[model samples]
Target: MSRRALRGVLGIALLLILWEGVARGFALPSYTLPSVSEILLSVWRQRQLLASAAWFTMAEALAGYAIGCVAGIGIAVLLSLLPPVRRGMMPAMMAINSVPVAAWSPLLLLWLGVGIASKIAAVALAVGFTVFLSALAGLDRVDRRTIGLMRSFGAGPLSILWRLRLPTALPLIASGMRVSTVRSLIVAIVTEMLGAYGGLGWIIYQAVVQIDFVSVWSAILVASALSLAFFGLIGAIERRVVFWR
Candidate 1:
């Protein structure tokens, strides 16, 4: 690893050490905050439980993320092709995004019930706006000079988009995708918290009600790990897709 990567690892290690020290030295009650070691123990002891919940949540998040990306990109492409409609649609998109997706969870749960569908919908809604705005910006942000040169070469709209615009916009879209990875997981969990038959969020809700703080922390740790893994996957794909950048 590079020095920067090493430093990040060291920083996380130090934080975990501090967290453990604070919880143990202060003699904090387990219900208040379990020590990092305790949380780890709980995680290991409850591996099956955590794994099942994490898998369920990951499936929902991935499904929703895929749907959101396709829909967002489709909208962006339509807007880009029909520039005149962009102006009219922009405000409406902004208006919808302004409302936090969590606020829609209750209604989603009521409509979709306490199954995976609600969580999936919540994740999709959370991720869609981000992908849409980023993709739209990417579609619109080509260098004027580069586009002029492409036009000078007699490159048509489709040719320019495939050969130039998309390449130029990939970095921005990748950034958006990276950001949405975490958001998708979070929204799914929060939605699950409201009402879910299974998932990490449901595990958390159960732990909370049972006053199993260690289990709670363990579930959170699992969720965090999943989010980090998802983010890293996106980063890797971004590196591959935008290799020049």
Candidate 2:
């Protein structure tokens, strides 16, 4: 493994050690605060359930993320081509985004059903604005001077957009996708906890209600690991996409 990967592993190990020591030293009740080993054992014992729930959550998150990215990019491109439309709609977009997803979860569940639809809608809504705004900003960074030069050279609008704007916006879009990827998982899980079938969030909620402290902690750990893995994957993709930068 690379030094960076080793460092990360070591840091996580240290944190786990600290957690184990604190829980044991404090003589915290296993029901209230189990040691790291207890949580790990719980995770091991419940691996099948955790894996199934994780698969469900991952599917929802990825599906929502894909939908949000496609919609955000398409809309942002249209807005970039029409400055007047962008100006007129920017504030409304901001307002829409300001509405908390948590507040909308119940309504989404009511409107979209308590299944995958509600979870997808919640996750998409949670991530769409960030992706749209970031992509717009990236598209806006296409230099006016470059466009003017292209015009002077008799380059068409389509040519300029394809060659300049698209490339220029790639990094920004990548960054937005990274944010959306993480947001999708968070919103999807939260939505599941609010109203859905099975997911890591639902598992966590169930464990909490059952007062299974170690299981709850294990679910949380799985969630964290999944999020970090997705984020790292996005980062890797970004490096490949923006290698020139």
Candidate 3:
């Protein structure tokens, strides 16, 4: 492994050691703070349950992310073509995004019900505005000189957008995608807490209600692992797509 990778592994190990020491030294209640070893053992005991929950939550996150990014791209394209719409829509989008994703959970649950749909919608909302801003900025930030030159050369609006603007915007769009991936997981889980058929968040809720702190910690660790894995996937894609940047 690389030096950076080794450093990261060491850092994580140190943090885990500190966590174990603190939990033991403080004699913390299992409900309040379970040790890493205990959490691992719980995970082992509940592997099947945790695995299913993780898969379900992952599906919701991924679905929502796809919906959000596609919708964001469409909105960005529309706004690029229509200045009036951009002016009118930006504030509303900003307002919605400013409100916490958790705040939307109840409303989404009310509308979408206590199922995977609600979780997916929440994730979409959480991920959308970020991607919208990035895509819009990417579409808007093209060089005026280049655009004018393209027009002088007889390039039409569609041609300019497809051939020049989109290429310029890809890096920013990819960056937003990478950023929103974590949000997607978070929003899905938060929404699941309010109501869900089954998910990591739902698992966490059940564990908490039963005061099964080990299960709670184990579920949380599973969620973290999922997010980290998804984040790494996006990072890899971004590196490929935005290599020039």
State the lDDT of candidate 2 residue by residue for 109-136, as single tens digits: 9999989988988887777777888889
Who is ahead in lDDT, 2 or 3?
3
Candidate 3 residue lDDT tens string, 24-89: 999998978888888989899999999999999999999999999999988898889888988998
Flag clash pairs in model 3.
none
Worst 10 residues of 1 by lDDT: 164-173
Scored against the true structure, residue 94 in model 2 reaches a CA lDDT of: 85
Q: Score each candidate by Cα lDDT.
A: 0.90, 0.88, 0.90
Question: Which portions of model 3 show Cα errors greater than 4 Å?
Answer: none
Clashes of each: 0, 0, 0
Best-to-worst ranking by TM-score: 3, 2, 1
Displacement of residue 147 (Cα, Å) in model 3 is 0.9
Candidate 1 residues 128-150, lDDT tens each?
88998898899889988998998
TM-score of 2: 0.95
Name the runs in model 1 displaced over 4 angstroms: none
